[model samples]
Target: MTKEAWDGTVTKKSRGLLDGSSMYRRLELRLTDGSTVKVRVSRDLWDAVSEGDQVTKAAGEDPVKQ
Candidate 1:
């Protein structure tokens, strides 16, 4: 199904360095419909989130590419 926004609760969090410099962060979430989704966000955004936190992202905006 298509969605305009992604609303979910974070279930897991991971962080690492890319190319030994840039930081990368990933979050595993449980959507409202019981589906799991993984999304990558920037270090700044990552710091604003934590496991168990609820978050919403614009459908077309890819956080990972930021």
Candidate 2:
């Protein structure tokens, strides 16, 4: 199963208008294994995020990156 955890190591973040009233935050993760992954979190998650936050998934559990 895909793991649901935050590694807390954010490298990049972006803000944009998601819909008409809501906003979106895109997070970029630079893993310790020298891999890059991107995740788009809801505004609710914004409060939980900081300068060094990341979202992670398990190796066999997570779907392959496209």
Candidate 3:
């Protein structure tokens, strides 16, 4: 799989069930490139960040708070 990297300010945080069975965490980001996207993240990473926090993900790596 191709790995992608991005840096952005988080706009929102949320959690929900997928198919009423699997739980998931998500972050909505406003990227440095001026686009917005939502990405699924681990529970630890989800708890580590908040709205408006800056975060970065390197290619093939998990996102980290900046």
Say which prediction, candidate 1 or candidate 3, comes out ahead on lDDT: 3
Model 2 residue 14 distance off true place after TM-score fit, in angstroms:
1.2
Q: Across residues 1-66, which tens digit of lDDT does each residue of candidate 3 receive? A: 129999999999999998799989999999999999999988998999989999999999888898
TM-score of each: 0.71, 0.52, 0.91
Candidate number that wins on lDDT, 2 or 3? 3
> CA lDDT of each candidate?
0.74, 0.60, 0.92
TM-score: the better of candidates 1 and 3: 3
What tens-digit string does per-residue lDDT give for candidate 1 at 1-66?
233577788889998886799877889889889999877776776888777888777777644211
lDDT comparing candidate 2 with the true structure: 0.60
Model 2 lDDT per residue over 36-65, tens place = 777776666555666665455455443222
Find the 10 residues in a row with the least total lDDT in model 2.
57-66
How should the candidates be ordered by TM-score, best one leading? 3, 1, 2
Clashing pairs in 3: none
Cα lDDT of candidate 1 equals 0.74
How close is each model in CA RMSD to the real structure?
Answer: 4.9, 6.5, 1.3
Which is the leading candidate under lDDT? 3
